[model samples]
Target: MWDKQVMKPVSEPANSPSYVQVRLKLLRDIATGVWPLGGRMTLSDLEARYGVSQSPVREALLRLEGDGVVVLHPHRGAVVPQVDAALLTQVYDIIGALQGMLARRAVDHLTRTHLRELEAHLARFDAALDGGDIVGAVAANGAFHGMLNSLGGNPQAKALIETRFALAQATRRLVGYSSGRTAEVKQQHQSLLAALILGDGEAAAQVLVAHADTARDDLIARLLSKGAASTAS
Candidate 1:
C-alpha cells in the first residue's frame, strides 16, 4: 500500500511557468520517494501522469539527470540512481567537505541581511516543528541549506552542493529522518547559523560535520532495523 503521506501534492509554482511546473512536480515526486531508487521512470508515464506534453517531461528528466537524481540508461530508460552504503558514505563525505569550505568562506562574507534571512528561515522551521508540519519542515530545511550555499559565493561549489543535497534528501526520506528528527535537526541548524554569525568558520564546520554524522547514523540504523524486521516477518 502506498502511503498517502508520501504522495505529496504536485502544485504548480506561482505564475505556473509551464516547463518549471512540470520539472518541479517531477522533482518533488522523486524527493518524496514516490520514484524510489533504481525505479524506472518512463517519459510516457510522466506525460500521462502530469498531463504535460513530452517536451517538458523530457527537459525535466534531463535536468534531474544532471543533478544525479536520475540516470539515463541506454536500454532501461531513466531510472532513479541508487546510492549504496559505500556511495552514500562517499557522497556525505563530499558534502561535508564542500559545505565546510563553503561555510568557512561564507562566515567572512555573511552579511547582516543574510543572517537575518537565515534567522527567519530558522523561525519558520521552528514554527513548522511546533505545528507538526512535516512538509513545511522539509521546505524550510531546504531553504536554510540553500541559503547557506548561495551565500557561500562559489557558483560551481554551490551547484555541486545543491545536487548532493538532493541526493541526501532521497536518502533522508528513505530512512524516515526528514521529518522525524525535526527538533534535533533544527537545533543543529541554529548552532551552525550562530557560528556563521560570529564569523567562526571552524565552529560552523564542526557543527555541520556533526549534523551530517548524526544523519548518517540515523539512516544506517533505520535501514538496518527495517531489514531485520523484514527478515523476521
Candidate 2:
C-alpha cells in the first residue's frame, strides 16, 4: 500500500509546476519498471504515497489510461499495461521511421553547436557505459536522440517520436539484461554522431536503423536464452 504523505517524488523537479505531480511520479515508476508490467496500481495507493489529494492522483491515472500505460478496471483500479512482442515491434518500427526522417533533415541543418552538444552527450554515455550504469546510459542515449530529433524542426513528427521513444524505454528494460552489449551500443551512438557531424544523413539513418535492429536481435536472443534455461530446468 502506498501512503501519499510518505511518497517522495522521483523524477519531477522539487517544484514541479504540473498539478500532475502524482502522475509524473507514477509514470516514472512505470517507465523504470519499478511498477513492472501488469503490476496493479490504485488511486488510493497513489494518493497515500505522494501525500497528495485524490483528485490529482485520479487525474493522473486517467491520463495514464489514455496514454495506454495503464488500464483501468471497474473493480481492480489500474494496472500497468503489458508489453507484448507485437507492440514492441510497432514501437521500434515507428521510432526507426521517424528517426530516419529526422536524421535526414538534421544532416542538412545540424550546426556546430548541435555537434558539440552531441559530443558532450556521447562522452557522458561513454562514462555511464564504463561505470555499468545501465539506467544512466539509457537516459543519455534518449537525450542524444531527442536532441537530434528536435533539431529536425517538425513539431508533429517530434511529438510522435517522443511517444514512441517512451514506449521504447518501457520495453528496453527487458533488452538491458545484457551488460556486455553496453560498449557496442555506445560505439553505435558514436558512429551515428560522427555521421551526423559529417552531414551525411543517409549514413546516420543507416547507423540508426542498424542500431535499433541490433537491439531487437539482442533482446530476442535473451528471450530465447531464458526459455532454454527454463526448459533445461
Candidate 3:
C-alpha cells in the first residue's frame, strides 16, 4: 500500500557516520511500509538494499530494535510487528496528547528565525495541497512538524513521539486522503501558525491534537473500506 514515498532529508553533520545514515534510510522505508507488518528483514536483504557491509546493517538494526521499531531474532532478521488498528489508535492518542503538550511549550521559545523556517514548510504544504500532490504534502507536513517539534526542546518527548511515526505513515499509505481533507489540514495549519504567532499555547495545542484526531479517524475509515473491498472481492 506504500504507493508513494517521499524522503525529505534533514541536514546532517558532515561527520555523521555511515551506520546512522543506513539506519535512517531503513527507517524511512519501514515508515512507508516497504517493510510490511510481520515481515522479516534479513541482514542480507538490508545489505543488498543499502549496498552496505555487514557491520553497518547490523548496527542499524540494533538502533531500530532499541526504538521498538524492530525485533531481532537470533540467526534470523528483524521482524516488523503487525500494528493493528486498535493499537494504532492508542498510539495516535498518545501522540496527540504529547505533541499537544510539546506545542504548548514550543510557544515560549519560538523565535522569528524558527517562525520563518516554519513558514517555509507551511508554504510547501500549501503548494503541495493546491497542486493535489498528496505525497509532497505529506513530506511538507512532516518537515513542518519536524521544525515545530524542535521548538519544544524536549528531546525525551521528541524521541517518544518519533518512535510512533512509522505507524502513522503506514496509515497514510493505506488511507490516502479523501476529497476536501487537504483543505481542512490547510486550515488547521493556518490556525496553528496564527496561534504560535500570537503566543497562544493553548490554541496551538488544541489544533495539533485535533489534527492527530483527524488522522485517527482517517485510519479507521480507510481500513474499514479495505476490509469491505476484500470481502466483496
Candidate 4:
C-alpha cells in the first residue's frame, strides 16, 4: 500500500509493465513542476518517495535524462533541469512550427467526426479550467492537441511532435492563466475549429502558430517575473 503523503498508487493493470507506469507517474510529477528544477534526488530517495523499488526508479531517471527532462550528474545524482529563456524560446518555436505544419496537412485528412471529438475535448478543457482543476485541464488540453496532431497522417511528423510535447510539458507549470487568458484560449480553440471546419487550411495553420506563439510569450514572461522576484528577495 502506498503512503498517501509520499506516493500515489498507479492505476495500471497488474499485468502491465510496472516500471513504465512508475516512470510515467514520475514524468507527470516532474512535468507539472512538483519537483523543483535543479533539485537533486538520490536513488534511495526516489525509491522511497515514489514507493517504487530501486530498479524502476533508476530506470525512470535514466529515461528522463535521455529526454532532457533531468540530468544525471556523476556525483550529484538526478536533478530536474532548470528552465532557461533561450531554451524555452527555441523549443516553443519548433513546437509552433510543428503545430502549423501538422495543422496544414491534417486539414486534408480530418473528418466531421474528428471535429466533433475535438469539440468534446474543448468542452472538457473549459470545464476543468472553470472548476480550477489544473491537472485535469492540462490533461484535457493535451488530449485535444494529441487528437489534432494525429489527424496529420504523418507518423514521422507526429513522432517528432511527441518529443517536443515532452519538452513543452516540463515548462507547462510556468504557463499560468488569467481569467482573460482563459477566455482567449477558448476563443482561439473556436477559431481554429471554425477554420478547420471550413477547409481553410491556411487560416487553421495561422491560428495554430499564433496560439503557440501566445503561449510561448506568456510562459517566458512568467519565468522572467519569477526570476526577478527571487533575485530581489
Instruction: Point to the candidate with the largest lDDT.
Output: 3
Per-residue lDDT of 126 in model 4: 92
How do all models score by TM-score?
0.74, 0.74, 0.81, 0.74
How high is the lDDT of residue 199 in model 1?
Answer: 93
Question: Per-residue lDDT of 35-118 in model 2, one digit per residue for the tens?
Answer: 777688766777677788866777777876776667888655688876665666676677788888878987766667778988
Quick one: ranking by TM-score, best first? 3, 2, 4, 1
Q: Which stretches of candidate 1 lie over 4 Å from their true place?
A: 1-29, 46-68, 178-183
The parts of candidate 3 lying over 4 Å away from their true place are 1-21, 36-39, 51-56
Against the correct fold, how does model 1 do in TM-score? 0.74
lDDT of 1 by residue, 1-233 (tens): 11144322222347855666776676667766777777898877888888988778777777777766688765445898876666667667877788888788777667677789889988987897688665566678778877787666666776676666666677666655544566678789889988998899999988988887777666667667766888999
In the order shown, the candidates' Cα RMSDs to the true structure are 8.5, 8.0, 6.4, 7.9
Rate residue 226 of model 2 by lDDT. Answer: 63
* Clashing pairs in model 3, backbone N/Cα/C closer than 3 A: none
On TM-score, the candidate that comes out on top is 3
Which residue pairs clash in candidate 2? 3-48, 3-49, 4-48, 4-49, 4-50, 4-51, 5-51
Residue 223, candidate 3: alpha-carbon lDDT: 72
Could you tell me which 10 consecutive residues in candidate 3 have the lowest summed lDDT?
1-10
